[model samples]
Target: MQAIAERSPLLSKYETFERGLPSHPESIKHLRRQGKDSFEANGLPTTRQEEWRKTNVAAIGRTSFERVSQDTNSLSHEQIRSFLLPDCIDLVFINGRFSHKHSQLEDLPKDIFAGSLANALVQKPELVEAHLGQYADLGHPFVALNSAFIEDGAFIHVPSGVTVEKTIHVLFLATARDGTPTVSYPRNLFVAEESSQVTVVESYGGFRDDRYFTCPVTEIVGLANSVIDHYRLGQESLGAFHVATQKVYLSRDANFFTHSINHGGALVRNDIQALLDAEGIHCTLNGLYLARGSQHVDHQMRVDHAKPNCHSYELFKGILEDRARAVFNGRIYVHQDAQKTDAKQSNRNLLLSKGALVYSNPQLEIFADDVRCTHGSTTGHLDDEAIFYLRSRGIGEEAARSLLTYSFAGEVLDEIRLEAVRKEFEEFLFTRLPKGDIVRQAV
Candidate 1:
C-alpha cells in the first residue's frame, strides 16, 4: 500500500493497526461497530464542549496522521540495562505493539494477571466484557473513539485476597520512522476483585525530540476491599502530543492511589474520572508536571460520589517555565443519594518565568446538603523568600534554584511507595530540569 493515504470514510488509518492486533475477531467487530456509532454521534469534542473549553484537540482531528511504522525499535536491547527495577513484571511495547523478546515477568503472585490486551481478549473475554467502559461516559470524542476502535489493550486482573508481590511495569516506545507523522492509542484495563491488592506502573518512552501523537484510554475497576496503586509516567518525545483518559470505578471499602508525572510532550491533556459507587471507598489523586519552552500541560479530574460514606482526596501541583502553560480543572460531584460523603480537591501551580502561565478551576457540585465537600485552586510563583533563605545559607544561586524547584515537586515523591522506582525517577527528573533563573554557581 501507499505510505500514507488521504482521509477515508471507511477504515481508520489503514486496513490494519501499527501491528497485527491480538486474537479477537469477535470483540474487534463489536468495538468497530460501537466506535463507528460513537464517532457518528459525536464528531469530535469541539471548543463548544464545556469540558474541552480550555484545551482543544481540533488540531489532531483535522489532520489524518500516518499509521505507525513497522521498523524495529532501537530501544530493544539497552532498555533493560538502563531499566530501573529487576524484581518486577515488565511488558515492553515498541510502536504500540507488544514484543515478547524484551519483556521480563517472574515471581508474580498467582492472583495477578498481566498480558497484552489482545491476549486478554482471547484468553479472558468474560473479565474484559464484565467491566470495560463502565465508568466513563462516551461523550468525549477521543474516549468514544477509543472505545469504538479498541483493538488490544493492557489487562491486569488481581484476584480476591491476593496481594501481588511484585509491581507490573508497562513501557511504551514511539519513534519517528520514515518522517511520517505517527500515532499510538495504547489502551489498558485493570480489574481488582475483592480483597485484592496490586500496583501498576506505566512509563512512556521513545525519542527525545520528535513529533508524534499518543492517545491512550485506560479503565480501572476497584472491587470491594481491594487496594490499587497506579503510577503513570509521561516522558515522551518533546514534540509529541499526548491525550489520555482514565475512568475508575470503586466498590465498597476499596482504596486507590493514582499519581501522574508529566515531564515531556508538546501538548498533553489528561482526563481522569473516579466513581465511588459503594460505601467506605477511598481514593487519592496526586500529580506533578514540569512544562517548559512553549509546552502545554492540562489535567482534568472528577471524583463522583454516588453512594454513601465514600471519601476522595485530590491534589495536583505543576511547575511552568519559559512560556509554558498548564491548566487544572477538578470537579467533585456528590449525588443527592450519596449521604455522608467526604471529598476534598486542590490544585496549585508554580510559575518560574515571566512568560509562563497557569489556569486552574476546582469545582464542587454537591447535591447532598449533609455531605462534606470542598474544592480550591491556586496559581502563583515559587516563594522568593524561600529561595533567598537558601541562598543566604552559603548556597549558590543556581543550587538554590535547583533546590527550590525540586522541592516544589518534592511532595509527589512522598506518595510513591516504591523506594527504588521513586529514587530512579528523582535522578532522571533532576537531570532533565533546566537551570532555571539560577545564573551563579557556588563551589
Candidate 2:
C-alpha cells in the first residue's frame, strides 16, 4: 500500500490531509485509519482499471485541492434560497459542516432522530458508531477517500411502527471565497426500522462560481417490512468535479426505491449498489443525466440478489450534446440460492450532436436456473422522422429537437412521486435544452 501511495503525486500529501481534519472519537479515528490504509493500497483509479475503462479522471488526480476550513461560514441565506424546498424539514450544510442557523430541526417526533452526523457521534456515540462505516465498500478509492475525511453530513433514523408524513431534505452547498479549488467529503446515514416508512431527498449544489471538488457517500439500511424512498440531485458548478457512492441494504419484505438526477459539473461519476439480504424484498433504481459542452457524466450500478423470492429493476437514461461524454454500466447478480429472483436492467442514451458520445453496458450474472433476469442497452441519435413530423406541424427545427429531447428524458422524471419536485425538474430541463426558450414558452 505504501509503495502505491508513494508513486502518486496527489497521494504524497496524505499526511498533510490527515492533519487538517479535527480530532474524533477512537472508533471513528480507527475507522478513518482503515480507510486511509485502504486508499494507500489502491490509490486513485485509472482508465486501465476495468471499472474505470471509459472514464478518465487524470485531470482530477493531477490537481491539488484544499480542504474547507472548519470556521469558514460566509455563505448567505439568499445564495442558497433558490435551491431550497418549501414546507419540508431542511438540513443545510456549508462547506461540509452542519449549519444550525440554516437548518430546521425543531418540532420533530419524540422517537425520531434527524440531524447532523457529527453531532450524532457526540451525543449518540453508540448509535452512530454501530452503523457509520458498516455498509460502504471501502475497496473503492473514492469511497475510501470520503471515509478517511468523514467529518459531517446528514443523519436520519426512524424507529419501528413510526411513519413520517413529511419528507426530509438534506442540502450540501460548496463555496470558496479565496478562489482556491476546494474539496468536501459529505457522508450520510439513513436507517428505517421495521414497519416504518420514510422519504428523503439529498441534494448537492454550488453557491459560488468556484472550481471545487465534492465527493459524497450515503448508506441506507431498511429493516424488515420497512419502506424507504430516496432521491439524489447533483447540480455543481461547471468547473467543479463531483464523485459519489451510494450503498443500500434491505431486510426481509422491505421495499426500497432510489432516483438519481445529475445535471451539472465538469466531470462526474456515480456508483450505486444495493443488496437484497433477505427474502421477499423489492428494490428499484432509476437515474437520469444531462451532459453538454464537453461535460462528462458516468454512472455504475450493481444489485445483488442474495436471497430467494426477491425482485430488482433498474432504468438509466442520458442526454448528451456537443462534445459531451457519458457512461452507463448496469450489473445485476443473482446468487445460486436465490432461485426465485427476478431482475431487469435497461440503459438508453440519446445523442443530440455528432460530437457527443456514450458508452452503455448492461450485464447480468445469474447462478440460479429458476431466476428470470434480463439486461439491455441502447445508444443512438434522435429520431429524424419524429423531428420532421413535429416540424411539419408548424414547430421550428430547434423547437422540434428540443421537444423530442424533453420527452425522452421525461420518462424518468414522470416517475417522481412528489409533484413539486417533478414540476421543478421539468422547468429545469426546459431551461437547459437547446432552443430552451421555445420549450419554456410553450410550457
Candidate 3:
C-alpha cells in the first residue's frame, strides 16, 4: 500500500515539476536532482514507520494537487497586509513566488541581505551556494520535495556585530484563483553572523478558502554569540494541508529561540530540529497547537547537544476539540562529549472532548553522565479542580473551561518575545476556543 501510494499520480505530477524546475550555476540544478532522487527513494512516510506511527498522510498522497503558479495578482494587497508584522521588513510570497510590489525592502542596512532566494541565487550565488541545501535532512520526504522544487522564498543575511532593530517578516500567501487544489514549496535560508542579533517571523496563510498544500522548509545558521528569535505561524485554511521542516544550527555561545503557533489546516505537521554544534549554546523550542473538527496537528522536535556546557529547553502545548487529533514527539540528545549539558523537555495536551485524541512522546538520550537531562509528557482533559474553582468564583461553566484552557496554552505564548505577535496569537486563540457547546463539557 505504501509503495502504491508513493507511485500515485500526485507524486508523478511532482516529478514532472521537479524535472522542469528552474536551476542556475549548474550546482543548484544538481541539488534539485539530488532532492528528486532522495524523495523518490524515501517516498512519503507510512504509518508503519516509527516516526509516523500516529500521523498518517495517505490522504495527502491521494489528493491530486496541482503545482502552484506564480500568478498572484488576484489577491489584493489589503488582504495580505493583515498578516504582516508591525514595524518589520516584510517579504511576501504569493504562490511560492516573491512579490516585490507587496514586500517592503526599503531602508535596510547596506550590508544586510533580505530578499527572495531565487534572486539571491542570481545576485549572491556564492553566499547562498555555501548553505543552500546543507542543513535540510534529505531523509525527510517533505524536505526533499521542497529542496527539489526550491524557488522563491525568504533569504536573509545579517553580518557580524550588526543588530536588526526591526524583525524580518516572511509571509507566504497561498491562493487558488483558478479554483484548483494546488501545492507550493516555500524554501527559506537565514544566516546570522558572529555576535549579530535579529528576530525573524515566518507566516504561512491562505487568501482564499481553496484547498491547497504548503510544504515549506527553513534553514537557519547562527554564528558564535549570535542571538536569534524565530517564530513560525501556521494559519492555513481549514481545507489546506501544511507540512514544514525547520532546522537551526548554532555555534559556540549562540542563543536561538523558536516559538511555533499552529491554528489552521486540516492536516498539519511541524518538524523542528536545533543543533547545538558548539559549546555554550542556548536553545529553546516552544510550540502551541489548537485543532478541532477532524483537524490533525503534529509537532516533532529534536535538540542535539554536541558539545559541552550547552543548555536546551523545549515545551509544547496543545488544545484539541471535537474529533481533532494531535501528536507531539520531542527528543533531547546529549552527546558523549557534551559534559555539563542541561536539557529539559515537556509536552502537555488538553482535550476538550472525548473524541479528541493526542499522542505525546518525550524522550531524553544522554550519553554523558555529568549531564542533567529530563523529559515529561501529559495528555488528558482540562483540570477539573481549576474549572470547579473558577465556577465556584461565579464564572459560568463555559467561561470557566475557556479560562482554564487559555491558561494552559498561555504558558507557551509568554515565551514569545515579540509583544505584537503574542497579542495576535492571543486573539486567534480566543477566537478558536471552542464556544458554548464544546466548552460546556471539557471539564
Candidate 4:
C-alpha cells in the first residue's frame, strides 16, 4: 500500500539513493510522485498476465538486493577499457551513478544535446520532465519501479534537420562489492525531433557479481520524417541478473530501426515496446540471443499501430545450447483507425541440444478491416541437411555444426549496418558457440 520509494526493503544500503534520487528540486517533484503512484498501483507483475506467465519474476522477490553502491576501489581504469566500443562517443555510469571523469565525450557531435538526468534536472527541469517516461507504459511493474527510483539516467536530444555522423554510446557498468547483493536502475531517455537522424548504441555490463540484479529501462521518441537507429547490447558478467526495457515512440512519416543482442548473463529478460502514434511510419525490429550454460533469457515485444498507413516488420531469432532456456512473446495491435497498415512478425529459434528449450508466442490483435497483418513463430533444432552440406565440403562434423549454427544466427547480425561494430560482436558470439570450426582451430 506504500510507495516503492518509501518501502524498498533494500534501502539504507545505498547512500546514493538516500538523497531522494536527485532531480530538479521543483519540476521533478510532481513526476516523482506520479512514479510512486504508478508503482504502488501495479506491483511486481505475475504469471496471471499473459506477457509475464512465461517469464517468471516471483522468485526474484525472495532474494533481497541492494542498490549498487558507489564503491569502486577494487576496479581499475585499465580493466574497463576492454569493454569499450569502437569509434563512438562514450559515457560511463558506475554503480548506478554517472562518472563524467571517466567518459569520452570528445567524439560526440556538436548539434546533439547530452547530459546526465541529475544535472538536467537542475538546468533543464521542464525539458526533462516534459518528455521523461512520456512514451513508456508505466503500467508495467519494472518500468514503474525504474521511474519511482529516478536517480541516475542519461538524456539526449537531437534537433530537427540535424544529421549526426557518429553513433552515441552509453555504457552502464555496475559492480557489487562487500558481498552486497545489488541492482542498478540505469534509466535513459532519447528524443529525436522532426527530420533528425541519429544512432544510439548501449552496452550493459557488470563485474563478476552474479548475485547482483540490474533492472534498466530505455525510452525513445521519434518525430515526423525522423530516421533513428538504436541497439541494446547486453554482456553482463557470469553471476548477474538483468531485467531491461526498450521503448520507442514513432510519429508520422518517421522511420525507426532497433537491434537487441544478448550474449551472457545468468537470468535476463528484455521488454521492448514500440508505439506508432502517427501515419506513414516505418519501423523494423531485429533481435537475437545466444544463451548458453544454465542461463535463462526472455525477450518480449509489443508493437501498436494507432493510425493509418503504418508499416512494421519484426524478426527475432535465438540459439540455445547446454541447459539454457528462452521465451519470446511478440504481440501486434492494430487499432480500428489503423487502416492500410502492413505488419508482419516472425520468431524462429534453433536449439543445439535437447536440454535447451525455447517458448515462443507471436500474437496479432487486429481491429481494422482494411489492414494486412500476419504473425508466426517456430522452434526447431539445427538443420541436418545444412550440416551435411558443410560436411560434404570436407568440414568436420563438429565444425559443420558450428558453421550452420553461426549462419543461422548471422541473419540477425547482418542487419546491423555498422560494419566494425557488427564484426566485434560477431567475434564475441563466435566464442559463445560450441567449440568447432573456426573457434576450435583458432583457439
Candidate 5:
C-alpha cells in the first residue's frame, strides 16, 4: 500500500491537508489517520473493479483539486436565495464551511441542535464522536477520503419525543476561486432519537460552468419509533464532478424515507446503503436523475434486511438524451434471520435519443426461506403511440414530447413531501425541456 500511496497524485494534497489541520481529540485524530491509511491502501476505484465497471473516474484521480479554506468569501444571501425553501430553517455552507451570515437558523427549535458539524465538534464533542464515522463504510475510497478531510458540514440532533414542525434545509454551494479547481468534502450526520420526528433537506449546487469536485458522505440514524424524512438535491455545475455516499440505519419500528434527485454534474455517482438493524422497520428509497449533452450519472443502492419482519422498497428513474449515459444498480439483501421480510426494487430509464445509453441492473439476495423479494429493471425509448396520441389531440410534436418527459420524471418528484421543493424542481424541469413554455402553459 505504500507503493500505491506513492503513486497517487492526491498524496501531496493529503500531506498538505494534514499539516494544516488544527489539533483535535485523540478519537477524531485516530479516525482521520485511519481514513488516510485506508484511502492509501485502497486508492481510487477504477473501471477494472466490478463495482466501478460501468462508471469510470480516471479523470478525478488525474486532476489536482486544492482544498478550500474556511474563511468567509464574498458570496451573499441574495445569490443563494433561490435555493432556500419557504417556512424552513436554512443552514448555508460555502465550499464545505458553514456560513452564519447566509444561514437562516434563527427559527431553529430549542430542543433541536442544527448547525455546523465543526462547531458541534468543539462544543459537543461527545455527541459528535458517538455517531461520526460509525455507519459509513471506510473501505470505499471516496468515503475514506471524505473521512480524512472531514472538517465541517451540517449536524442535526433531535432529542427524544420531539417533533420539528418545520423543515431543516442545509445548502452546500461550491465556487471556483482564482481559476484553481477546488474540492470540498462535506460530511453530515443526522441523528433522530426515540419517538422523535424531523424532516431534513440537503442541497448541493455551484456556479454554472465552474470546474470543481465535491465528495460528500451523509449518515442518518433513526432510533426506535423515530420518523425521518430526508431529501438530497444534487444540482452541481455542469463542469463539476460529484461522488457522494449515504448510509442509513433504522432501529425497531423506525420509519425512514429518502428522495435523491440529480440534475447536473459532468460526472456523478451516488452510493446509498440502508440497514434494517431491527424488526418492524419500514424504509423507502426513491431517486430521479436527468442527463443530457454528454453527461454521465450513476446510482448504486443496497438495502440490507438484517432482522425479521422488515419492509423496504426502492424505485429509481432516469431520463437521458443527446449522448447522455446513466447506470442504475440496486440490490436487496435479506439475512438468514430476516424472515417475513418484504423488499422490492425497481429501476426504469427513458432514452430520448438514439445515442443515449442506459445500463439498469436490479438484484435480490435472500437467505431467509420465508422472505418475499422482487427486483426489476427496464430501459427504452419514449412510447411513440403515447406521443402520437398527444400530437393528434392538438399538441405539437415538441410539446407532446415535453409533456411525456415531464410526466415520466414526475413519478419520483411527487414523492417529495415538501411542496416548495417539489415546485422548485418542477420549474427547473420546465426550463430544461424543449418547448418547455408550451408544456408549462398546457399543464
Candidate 6:
C-alpha cells in the first residue's frame, strides 16, 4: 500500500479534490465516496495482476495530472467543425464539461432528454439519481477514478415507444494546459426505455501533439424490446493516454450493437462489457484499431449471458506498424441457466512490420451443456500472395499494400449502418495510407 501511494500522486490529490467539490445530492456524494474508497484500496493495477499482465501503465501512475474544475470555452465553432458529423444532433464537451455554446439540441424529439449530466442532476435530479453509478463496476481503478470525479458528460434518455430518427453525437475534446499534464473524467449515462429505438455516437479527440489523460466511464441500459446502436470513436492525440470503460445492461428482447474504432493515442486501454439479463436478447460488439510508432492499445471485452435463448457476436481487428503493440482479450460467459445461448467471438490482427506485436486471446466459459459457443483468434502479416496478385493487376506496390489494408479494415467498417460515420472513417483511412490518392482511386 505504501509503495502504491508512493507511485500514484492521485491518492493525495483526490483528498483535495473531494474537499473542494461543489455541493451535490446525498446519493451522488455517497457514490463519490464509494469511488474514493475503492480507488484508495486498489490504487492502480500493475503487471503482476493477471488482467494487466501484458499492459503496463507505470507512466500514468507516476504523472501528477491537473484536474480542471470548469469547462474551457476557448474553442470556436470552426475549430471543431471537422470533428462534427452531418445530419446529427451534436453535443460537445470541452475538458469534460458540456459546451452549450457549441451544441445543437434544437432537433431533439419530444419526451427525449439529451444534454449534460451535471445539468441533468440539477434540472432532473430524480432521473439522474436513478441510473447514475448503477451499472459500471468500481473495482477497476480507472472506473473508480472516473466515478470519484463524476461531474459532467453526456446524458441521453429515450422515453418509451419513441424512435430517434437522427443520430445523437456526443463529442469529448481534450486540450493541453501549460503547467502540468491534465486529466478529465467524463461520465456518461444512456438509458433507452421499453420499446424505444435510438442510435448514439460517442467520440473522443484531443489537440495534436498534446500530452494528457482521459479516463471516461459510460453506462448504458436497454429496457425490454429496446433497439440501440452505439459507436465509440477514439481519436486522441498521439501523445496522450486514454483509458475508458463501458458497461451495458440489456433486458429481455432487447437488441444492442456497438462498434469501437480506435485510431490514435500513445497508450490506450478500452474495457467493454455487456450483460444480458433476460431471455431473447441479441447483442453485437465490433471493433477496429490502427496503431503505429510506439503506441500501445489494449482492448478487454466480456459478454455475460445470464438468461436462456440469447445470442451475442464479437469481432475485433487490429493493424499495427513500426514498433506498436496491441492486445485483445475477449471472453464470453454462459451461465447454467443460459441454455440455447449462441455466442461467437473472433479477433484478427495484421502486422505491418517485424517489430509490431499483438496478443490475441478469445475465451469461452460455458456452464450450460446444451449451448453452442465458438471463439478464434488470428495474428499474422498481410498475405503475400494476395498482395502479389493485386500488384499483378497493374497496381503499384504501395497502392496494392494500402488497398489490401483497406480491404482488411473494411470488413468491420462495412458493418456501420450510418453512412455519414462510415464515410468519415473511410476518409480517415485514406489519409493515413501511403500513396493515399492512388489507394483512394483504386478503391
Candidate 1 residue-wise lDDT at 227: 95
**Model 6 local distance difference test score:** 0.91
Tens-digit per-residue lDDT, 195-266, candidate 5: 999999999998887889999999999999999999999999998899999999999999999999998899
Model 1, 181-295: lDDT tens digits are 6777777888999999988888776576777777788889999999999888888788788888989999999999989888888889899999998999999988998899989
RMSD of each: 4.3, 2.2, 3.3, 2.9, 1.5, 1.6
**Lowest summed-lDDT stretch of 10 residues in model 1?**
434-443
Tell me the tens digit of each residue's lDDT in model 3 across 252-345: 9999998999888988999999899999999999888989899999898989899999999988998899999999989888899999999999
Pull out the clashing pairs in model 5.
none
For candidate 3, report its TM-score: 0.94
> Poorest 10 consecutive residues of model 2 by lDDT?
1-10
Q: Residue 317 deviation, candidate 5, in Å?
A: 0.4
The CA lDDT of each predicted structure is 0.78, 0.86, 0.86, 0.80, 0.90, 0.91
Per-prediction TM-score to the true structure, in the order listed: 0.91, 0.95, 0.94, 0.93, 0.97, 0.97
Candidate 4 regions with alpha-carbon error over 4 angstroms: 1-27, 72-74, 435-443
Give the lDDT of residue 46 in candidate 2.
93
Sorted by lDDT (best first), the order is 6, 5, 2, 3, 4, 1
On a 0 to 1 TM-score scale, where does candidate 5 land against the true structure? 0.97
